[model samples]
Target chain A: MTATDRQATGATWLRRNRQVVAPVLFLLPGLLFFLVYVLLPVAQSVQISFFRWDGLGEPDYVGLANYRELAGDRAFEVSVINNVKWLLLYLLAIPGGLFIALFLNQTVTGIRLYKSLFFFPFVISQVVVGLVFTWFYDPTFGLLNAILGAVGLGPVNVLGDPALATYGIIVAGLWPQVAYCMILYLTGLNAVDPEQVEAARLDGAKGWRMLWYVILPQLRPATFIAFVVTIIGALRSFDLISVMTNGGPFGSTRVLSFYMFEKALGEYGFRMGYGAAIAVVLFLIMLVFIAYFLWSMWRQERGA
Target chain B: MKTAWTTTAALALLAALPATAQDESLSGTLTIFSDMSNPAPRAVMEDMAARFDEMHPDLEVELTIIEREAYKTQIRNFLTANPPDVANWYAANRMRPYIEAGLFEDVSDLWAEPEIAENLASTKSALTVDDKQWGVPYTYYQWGVFYRADIYEEHGLEEPADWEGLKSNCQTLLDAGTKCFAIGTKFLWTAGGWFDYINMRTNGYDFHMQLTNGQVPWTDERVRTTFANWRELIDMGAFIDNHQSYSWQEALPFMVNGDAAAYLMGNFAVAPMREAGLTDDQLGFYQFPLIDPDLPMAEDAPTDTFHIPSGAENKEAARAFLRFVVSPENQTLINGGDALGQLPVNAASEVDEDKFLEEGFEMLSANAPGGIAQFFDRDAPAEMASVAMEGFQEFMVFPDNLDDILGRLEQARQRIY
Candidate 1:
């Protein structure tokens, strides 16, 4: 057959099938992978939450008993309280990042190096960060204790005291998280229109007022991203706690993620069902915030 | 017909390849998941595997040494999916869950072998569950107070034999501005050592076993008494301040530097203690002092064992490896004759001639009305042990929190059981 005839047939076939077939074909691989890996495990976890499985033997069905058990578990209560503290304290990173961003916003000599230096913590892996801070907080000879002793104030066992362990880990997490927010704001600042800023300055907008009304309104996208990531980061704060204290000093440092790990895979011996229930609770928590975040983003997008 | 005859003879030899008993020519890949990832011990383990490989020319052994912490979690998953031929684990309660899950082979027949059985006879009770042997313990070490002899002498503190003597020494040491005990409970298991000693001393070995087995409740008056006795040292400020900030190894500096006088730890800690510049002449070993004159004395001796996974493809090779690991030559090499202070489980082995081992062995075997008990975590279910260890750590940090901690542990005990 002639080349024109083959081309015509191909174009006709594409024109005939582009509407329904193409979209399904495009969605096949990703949809299949998500269903298998993400959705299926979640469903299985929810199912297992009702039983008493040890991850090895047959799961004995004990309907809502694990949840009932959670209600009375002191460790679970401690873990939830610590998670709330983590979420609240982790919000500091958003403002912390903004302050650093504002301070470093000027175009000065060697500012690129300074910006990268400020961004160093985010570049570090959480495990390394945890180790560094763990050494720093060591009560006997740690830098923090050494300084405190010099000042005649503390020698406080920051990572050891039940009252202070979670805060110590959250501060470690914030080191990286603050750096993350700073980078987000830096990029958003770059996108800020210079004309609008100059116009706001002409209208007598200065320092705090300039930041709040003029710059922050324009930096809405960045703030939104920072808020979303900070909240998610707080909930997903496991590695720092794991490396710093292993949810220790009487399990006071345990967030939901770390507590679930201790239950499911730690030397605590398999309580897979209970771990799943913990995971379900954490998921519901994230789901609520996720809905709120999406709603806000949707409102912004509609206006934009 | 003549070719068929020769082929049938060849097939018959192939059928007889894997003999039930000890076969000199067992040929297959033997996979081992070992948790001995330390530099010195891992080198010794690798050498043993190489020598075993050379002895059985056709048998190929694959030794995979995993980081100790990661190995604990990985073993649960790997034992069921694509299991290895051999795996190393702690002997008693640590091995129970897997044994009950049918993940490990019984290994009773290996115990029946006269040579292996004779050397490992003392450990027979440790490796057995339900009247059947489950594993062969290759090495174990003693846990006791390793103290600074020079400091003890300078301060005129005698090695304590009873509660009163220990308290006196602690008081003298405190007056001298030196802490009595150096401990770090950041990882939680270090606290388990204290609990084991307390529980064993307060309520004899049988009671300890019963308590660990869930036959006794945390609310039992006996359990409360153990806590009360431990709280004495805590109230007296005998421990390093802010001990929760250091790991067990990190806390050794206090004892080694003479700021603290004693350490309740395993014999394995000797290497690090020595590495910290403490000489053998400066350091001394003693059993944890007697708490109750009436109760029998029992020490914490955690035995390390090797077991064949039930799903192992080459059982004969796995048994051969176990036999080789427990041999006198391998034990001596791994324990390092008069070097690292580890004790091999093989009774007939010639090593463990060091001062600490000799002293520890005497303390564990000679004066005890009761036999040895595994450490608290090793003796108890892993789940209960975690809660109990956490409670002990909390109690150490806040002595006033004892009742609250015990109440919480009781809640966990009921729920976990």
Candidate 2:
């Protein structure tokens, strides 16, 4: 009686598990594609960092020689420092965007259109943004210079001056980033609990105190997304640098991403080995921040 | 289950495909990776391709006209992977690394053909890397000062013969409210042109040779003197500011609209000028004024060439195309047009009665004292070229720091060699 009952139970278990089995079968195809295209290439790039190879021909095995040389490269050092500058300055966009979002949050005829119009720069390619800013910075016949002349202030060489060029490019980069942050804030603001704001006001909370106590805490998710994107965008600053300056005026605008490109592919001779070395170094540095972010997310998840 | 079976079937089909994709025959399609994307050259090559197809009906020539900047990256990638049957490159040092790596086919045999040999006599050495001819010379343009005729007339200026005269002409043009010169150094090559001319005039041919060859130190007095002349031009307000922000093509409008009186540029600028609505009556070309008049003229012209990649699929077709490109008939077709604006590399190509061609022809035949390659940047190794240009730009911006810049260039040269 017991054996027969056990057999009947096993048959029922197999029938019920068909639903799970079918879903797993469907998931396999997509998971394989994701593994092949995305995960594999990333793994390969990391693996490649350990060897010295040009884009052409076979790669030779090198034991951390590329990393050793990168340590001594002054240009590499400059690129890392510039990357830090880009990261810090780029975060300014989130606050700036939030401020703009709050200002334009009201409904006053065509407000939706205004929001979309303000978001325009984010949609266009960064290459186009770089070109527009390059023209804007042109010392002669540029809008900036024309304005300077009108005010009787002598012209300032924004791009040509090494001290100002990186900052100038960062400002151009921020134009679109701010728009992105603004949209995130606007979405977060829409979801803010209205009853809580009313309660805070009843207790005399207003302006900065009100924002700090109630509004800011509610915007955490949006700010978190904004901070992550801005940091990634700042670290991966290549297209704009390539288009605007090609790391020119003596490599003054070179960030790590652009420097990696120059080392690997640009006219500086195909030092793919040297370039991979640079990439590995860049990856390790990026890993530090990424690891910290992962830890933070894990703690948040545990708390939730 | 259905999707898995489909994927497996697709993979099986792909794996079963033949290795070679082309049809079985001597006359299959041949692809060309070319940077001559301008409509004029595209049309000329298309016509030639059609003609070649007619002669060899079985074989087809497929020409891909890529943009200049993209083409550089594309060609490098192509050469590394599935290289096109034929491709274009710069002669001299630009082709050196490719030649050294054995990436290009040695086409010395093609040069032995009488017509090809005779035609490339002037630029044969450039195409000949390490005593082996790796490519065929196609088109070349002479570079110098191109100015607005109307502005020069209005300012009572004639084409200057010496450095001082050129300086005075610039001053007069500036005082008259027209920008004396329009330059776009944003691409970095334009600044190299200024350095080349200054060095060519002051140091003459031999030093120019030594400088590019890395036989002379970049901090040498001759090199410093050249920078000093360039600095003088900058301080005098003889050149426009923000030259680094615009490309040469973007800056052409200044000269076209009479905003700038002159452009120190290659003969290619003439075509762009015409495109910008400036007529021959409004535009004129002159040799860069010499600091020492008696110094021998060494040409600063750059030549365009083509090479067959080592791993090219159609080696025979590639050779045939190279031969046809430098053949007198095809050379005439390329050089006879108003668009190309250059002397034919092939000697036998008749200069058609085209007026535009006449100006370029006269410039090449008369002004060339001896054929000199462009500048140190093009002639030197790519690494050295990058550093040297950085030094040149720095010196232009901060002339008082000449010692520091020259010292840097010297160190860079040492690092390169």
Candidate 3:
């Protein structure tokens, strides 16, 4: 064919296929990234979990050995239990945030200043938060002990005691987390229908009744987001634990994420297969929440 | 442009000097990845690289000093994908994984050289794995009781000669409202130093070696005996309170402020204590008091080392760099009081006249008749060392939890070994 004739044919084909081609072209980069960065690594992690490897030399297929070892591993048990504690205790931030939001949702002088002041914790890095709380809970000279001593109470060694270490770290985590949830609720409260509040007020609904029946339902989207973020934060609590206690006072502060790192890439940790196994277990735990979240969001979209 | 001019200048200088036969033959880029990121050690490493660069007219020496903590994890990455000609690492089981993976060059020939074979004999076994040497030791430090002499004198207590004497002194110190030892178990390895000294003293060096080598059960009665010895100090509250919350560095203020009388630590502790203003008269060094009179004394002397990656392109340049690192002259210069402030691996090298360095040298060489061990983490496989150190920390905190801790450790031993 002549060049012009071939070009005309190609242009005609492109014109016809533009609708399908354009969207796919637009999606290709993101899809390629998701596949390579997220999906491939996840698949590789699952595959590696079934092997015996130390990040050096060839990996040996060990069937279910790494998982089996995790089942019996005491450190793994402590990590799983601590992860649960983090999940349950971390949820406290949701209500804590809601209360702070309600209190701050006022038409007062410098309300913006108050809101920013309340949101301050979220602005700081988790590392700095961990360090600040570490000093705050210091047994000898910490503010916690200083306050306790004023009341004729204890000079409790919070982080030094395995029983108390995780709780102390959770408190540190909650500071920033509560601030995050507060910001979400503040945004959600702004979108709440004022006419519904007026209607509730005319119906003699106020305080507990108004909040329970009228306000809370309007805050559902924010609550859902808060729950999702809080759950994920609890599951991936590595930095605070690493910074504050480093899974210490004898590994009492370790969560699944921290344990996975300790087994895989920590100073002494090179058990790649075992680390991958822990990652798989953590992924499964997170999967349940993620699947639920996705389903709920899908149902809501359909309902709307 | 600056580098080119310096290279030219260095080449001209090398030509002027009577060049050694080996020096003329070495021509390539020598890359060194070092974890000597501390102020003094970083200077020493940079100086070494510059000197090495200057000595070889045609060879280009490149040095990267990673932060000490970061280098531990990053070494695994670079060794596999982008191997340097020479790299820094610790001795003993710390290097085992790299050796087994064949990432580290078998430098048995370097060890066979008379200069290394004769002078670096003390740390040879530490760098050996599977009957082959993998690296050369450059520096190490003695681990012992770094005590407050003023406090000892105030209490009229002499340096303890045996376990009984040590206990009595601790009792005296405690009675005087001072904690005996200021150790921070927060990092876990500080407790490992305590375990090493007690175990080495109680069961002798051979048993300590076998246990670390994973040939003995954690529940072995001999191990229990070691714990019982450690327990005496724990029960008496010899350690500072809330030690688990402090790092080794954080715990120092206790000794400096006289809240604690001493610390069981490496010679590196001396510099910090001095900086904290403990004069030589106030500060003292003593071999960890003998626990078992008949066992003969063994000591913990963690050796830091250098190795050429097996994947290195310029093995010859790397070997020459390693040789230069361990030569008596360089060893003395780099390990001087102002440099690493640690003992030189080369016996022929002069020990820095710093009080702690001299005392550490004398103890490691003349007094430690039984043997020398790399500290707990270096001697034991990484996984086991971490697990065992955690157990040690727990045991210190809750002495009553000894049985439970030992049971968990035994389980780990079964799994790990």
True contacts kept of each: 0.85, 0.44, 0.85
Error of 3 at A210 (Å): 1.0
The DockQ-based CAPRI class assigned to model 3 is high
Real A-B contacts recovered, model 3: 0.85
Clashing pairs in 3: none
Clashes of each: 0, 0, 0
| Model 3: per-residue Cα lDDT over A2-103, one tens digit each | 999999999999999999999999999999999999999999999999999988789999999998888888889999999999999999999999999999
What TM-score describes the B chain of model 2?
Answer: 0.88
Error at B400, model 2, angstroms: 2.8
- Top-TM-score candidate index: 3
- Compute DockQ for each candidate against the true complex: 0.73, 0.34, 0.81
lDDT for B41 in candidate 3 is: 94
Instruction: Provide the overall lDDT of each model, using Cα atoms, as 2-decimal numbers.
Output: 0.87, 0.80, 0.92
Deviation of model 2 at A280, angstroms: 2.2
* Candidate 1 lDDT: 0.87
**What tens digits encode model 2's per-residue C-alpha lDDT throughout B1-417?**
999867655554453343212222235677888888787777766776666555554577888888876777677788878788889888888888777667899989988988678777888887877788999888877778888888898878999989999989988887888888898766677878888788888888778878888899977877878887888888987767666656788788788888899998877777778878988888887878778777876667788888899888888888777877787777877776554657677777766564445665676667767556755567877777876776676666667878977886787677567
**Could you give the candidate ranking by lDDT, starting with the highest?**
3, 1, 2
Ten-residue stretch with the least lDDT total in model 3 chain A: A66-75
- B1-417 per-residue lDDT for model 3 (tens digits): 999877777665666376333424477799999999989999999999998887786789999999999999999999999999999999999998898898999999999999889998888889889899999988999999989999999999999999999999999999999999999889999999999999999999999999998899988899999999999998899999999999999899989999999999988888888899999999999998888789999999999999999999999989888998999989999999989999999998999889999999999999999999999999999999999999999999999999999998888888788
